[model samples]
Target: WADGAVGPEVAAAYSARRVRLLDALAGRGVAAYGRSGMNVWVPVPDETGAVARLLQHGWAVAPGARFRLDSPPAVRITVSPLTEADIEPLADAVAAAVRPSPARSYR
Candidate 1:
């Protein structure tokens, strides 16, 4: 919020959408790290692959490699500024793109 704070209704909508996205991702077996309120970091087997897959489904996520070479393969999913109705679809796309392999903690 560059201009102080948002109106009550806008704030409520953002909060509700964030919750919806978090719930949907959790339901599909996605474990997210970092701040759950904003940019969520989810480590995967291949960040590049996941981003490509998500892009095909209409959602675009940034790979960790884009910012750092030391970080493990991860995707940054934005929860805020998202639509309530699109939450489930994005979650489904994530599930399809990132599958938990053996020896992984994502379950």
Candidate 2:
């Protein structure tokens, strides 16, 4: 392994951080898959908007459409390499992402 040692404690800390983020997203109507490990694949109602919102808050995620055709709007959030401090901001951004914006009236 090129990346140094990863013990149980390190792994557990990351898992806890991921779970917090996942729970935060769940409150926003976003669902995360990957029952095991640190795989964070969230199926958002608006992949484009979700990604944009996350990006606006200094977070990055993989768009589902980039990997598959006929796929729903989704984004991938990898929590392994990220720091635990990221959970709050990421959660806040994710929660804000699901909010409906003002309606636009077409003339």
Q: Which pairs of residues have clashing backbones in candidate 1?
A: none
User: Model 1: per-residue lDDT, tens digit, 1-107?
Assistant: 44647666665665676667767888988976643245667788998789888899888899887756687788988677577678888889888889854575756
lDDT of each: 0.76, 0.74
**lDDT of candidate 2 over 1-107, digit per residue (tens):** 12557777777766776787788777766667655456577777788898898888888888878766786777877788777677777877876775667699999
Among the numbered candidates, top TM-score falls to 1
Candidate 1 error regions (>4 Å): 1-12, 34-37, 67-70, 100-107
State the local distance difference test value for candidate 1.
0.76
